[model samples]
Target: MPSATLRQPPSIPKWGRPKQTTKKLDWAEIKVIDLSTYDEPNGKQKLAEELRDAVHHTGFFSVTGTGLTQEEIERQYDIGQAYFDLPLEEKGDPKYRCDFAKGNYFGYRAANEKKIMGTAVLDNVESLNIPKFIPSNSHEPFPHFLHPFRPEIESFSRRSLDIASKIFTLFSLILELPETYFSDQHRYDDASEDHLRYMMYHPRPAADDAKVQNTWSRAHTDFGSLTLLWSQDVAGLQLKTPAGEWKYVPPVPNGIICNVGDTLSFWSAGYFKSTIHRVIRPPEDQAHIHRLGLFYFVRPGNEVDIKPVASPLLRRLGLVGEDAEEREPVRGLEYVRERVKDYHDHGDYADKKGKKFKVRNLEIEDEAS
Candidate 1:
């Protein structure tokens, strides 16, 4: 396999962020907590408590196993490395087809194609997204490249799905909901039970300004419920710290990074934040080569409504106004479409000015950095 070391990034000026700032979350301190021991019976309980605080306070954290083994996580990483080692031409066979409503599913996305929110600069990275278990009877045209990858990637998917369920139970418990409330919804076939995965391979930026990779997924929030991520040890992933600084998420041994998405944020009545994050290649001077990550996104079914549930926290946060507004649930497909549009057009509202927008309302365009 060709090593990522063979393809280092070109230099670019770091803008958007200040070289030093007070709003930044300290990666060093977070890592100490992230790698702390939680092996005893009460460890799980303590871990959950700390996790809730981290999610609320920092919007990001390094999570140790809820159930996955280090060996198991490594296996998935190996699978991704093997796939990335494939010839560019070989991987391009299905040829990056995208629908407005499905995000980047079934395609090869170049950098800068998907514009960053509130930034003029494009990113520097390339990626592929593969969905699991395409309903055989469904009419949506599943891409062909996805076929060869299923056998190799299915293991990764299953692992993610298992973890998602486990995490959901914990999240449900934290929400004070019945243990079965979240898991029981998966029984129906038409439930829009999607397990989406992202395999991102960030090549070094080109020396020429015209060909930079989209550094990382721009400053955006996930569309669905929650996300589980296994990021490379390389430093690049940054989240908005409570004080407004961008803190790097350092890798923890066998740890999986997880976060809530917009829908969950809405459902939780703002108790859990759907934090905004972005990816950028480490400075060219850094020793790391390619930065890769495998993301497992747990989302709600297509038809599920999204609104603020009544909670003391919700009322305190002013999420529930005098009039309880029930935001219409966005169809999973429509949410993806707006995302593609925004990726191409750069988040300018497509609809008329002053028009009302609904949940999952995205305006980013699809363009490679």
Candidate 2:
């Protein structure tokens, strides 16, 4: 709901020569877990155990039985399509477009402006970032013409957060802490930055698509504790394995894709995987499709300290950092702000310099190099 006058429209027909590349990945299936069992006494623990393994390994999973009916899901999508169908000028109303350059993403970002990868080419994607909305929510309103859709958006975002809240319970249990540990930190009132993002990857010319990999988003990590993505039919979303192979993460019927983020990985002291991921060109069947992506990103409260937790499991696995100084805690909001600022400014991670980070067993030493 963060509104602003926007600039730099995402015009797909305007692009440069395709880059040359000769690499392709053979995608495989990912894990799928049913959440309907969550109500049983042992069900919650079992779910946590199953999730622990998934996060410990690939950090990606598909969840079904969310009780968020397909009708509601499609309703939001249809409404989103309505907004996207507006004249480019209306959608890009500078008063409502998100100014990402200013570190605020509460509005629209025209297609082809976000450079997810540092390549000279811009990404062929447009996104609308909406913050949480309660009657008393602290946010700006959409342009008057778009006001009719606000109720649907607000309701959808709340439902999305409901699921995230349950997932937080599982995470707290997995970390051997009170079930409320994570949920308490993510309450709507004072949470750091949680958003519902609507995205579209404009279909590119074959040459440009190949040059930019059917899409332009490079392999990168999410900025928060968890990200809930409503499944889309396009075939470009891919995950990188520890073996360095890329695999397609296709949508499952009635499923919502969930992925871990940098904050969760840090909190777990690298016990869980915040795997790297990217998007590529779609399959031949989907070549003409312009993909629509729906996502809910969850972060902790601003004052929460995102430090390694004192958990018996992390110690047993020897994943905790040896450099206590390097692992010094940072506020959840500060961590998010710095990481985002670095990427927006330099088109890369801030790890190369003073904003060092530590997550998992990477080639870097105690701190990012």
Candidate 3:
């Protein structure tokens, strides 16, 4: 008998980048770090010094020369757009939905599932979080629509981490520690909450948007160590400045925006700033367009202790005391799971202005105006 032939998966349609908004909005002065020189003798140190002010003050910046081509980045976006285009019943299968009550955020999240700001207007954002491609995560639910592109998705996920690893090295150098200190704690093979996310914000009527303060997403800090967001054109992302001003985060062509998160801030004993950010309805020029986003959220290894690092700078600044090492330990997974639950288990996106979300000794303001 003749051997059977193997079947190949269908290809995903191409996705084009959207045109930028024409509105002259207030833009933030975010510094851009070029990584092309990262392999030079003193490159890492130089980059570290350049990045110091941004991390300490704004907690946001952009990166260029990451060696990822526009074609490769757009391919991932195409895959994500195709997945979101599937029918609700097919894409939002019960088995693949996120288990927020259990603090598991590894699957699909449908849009408009809950009300916003105690109003009748439902949340306008939807997202799908794909965990790291490791054997330990094989048991997690994955969408069947994306199975065909697994190889490409896996490669993209790993490459995103490689870029993040370089940034981590810069952080370590900035703290005057071994270059690999932060990267080692975020090994890709380890079981953690790291995810490559595909998210979208649908447009709502202006009247309904007004009812919810025009917030597509509430103001809050990210829950991980670091976040990498691939730049896209539809406008609405804004970051809160130390001066309490909300300025738009402008998109850089072929560049990735980076930000510090709660865990990194915790590990540095408040030395690293975790700035608050949110998405609002796009300006009238782009309000009808859907805002698609690609992101990689980096979490420390599940077993790594999240206590304040023993950095000389932190010590000299009095951010960490001699007994810092003796403080009760909180593992990476423990804090992340608790945070997911605290942010998502509720039935509505009520006003949480004065609320505090705590995990052990680390706590962050749950909401911002």
**Number of the top-ranking candidate, with lDDT as the measure:** 3
Clashing pairs in 3: none
Model 3: lDDT equals 0.91
lDDT of each: 0.52, 0.70, 0.91
Give TM per candidate.
0.70, 0.83, 0.97
Give the TM-score (vs. native) of candidate 2.
0.83
> 139, model 1: CA deviation in Å?
6.2
Tens digits of lDDT, candidate 3, 1-369: 011123575876888788899899999999999999999999999999999999999999999999999999998899899989999999999988999988999999999899998888999889999999998888887887777778778889999999999999999998888999999999999999999999999999999999988899899999999999999699999999999999999999889999999889998998899999999999999999878899999998989898899898999999998888888888989989999999998879887887899987878897888
Off by over 4 Å in 2: 1-25, 114-121, 134-137, 321-327, 346-369
Better of 2 and 3 by TM-score: 3
Error of 2 at 18 (Å): 26
**Candidate 3 segments exceeding 4 Å error:** 1-7
The local distance difference test score of model 2 is: 0.70
What are the per-residue Cα lDDT tens digits for candidate 2 across 161-231? 88988888888899887888888878876756788887877777787656544554656777788999987
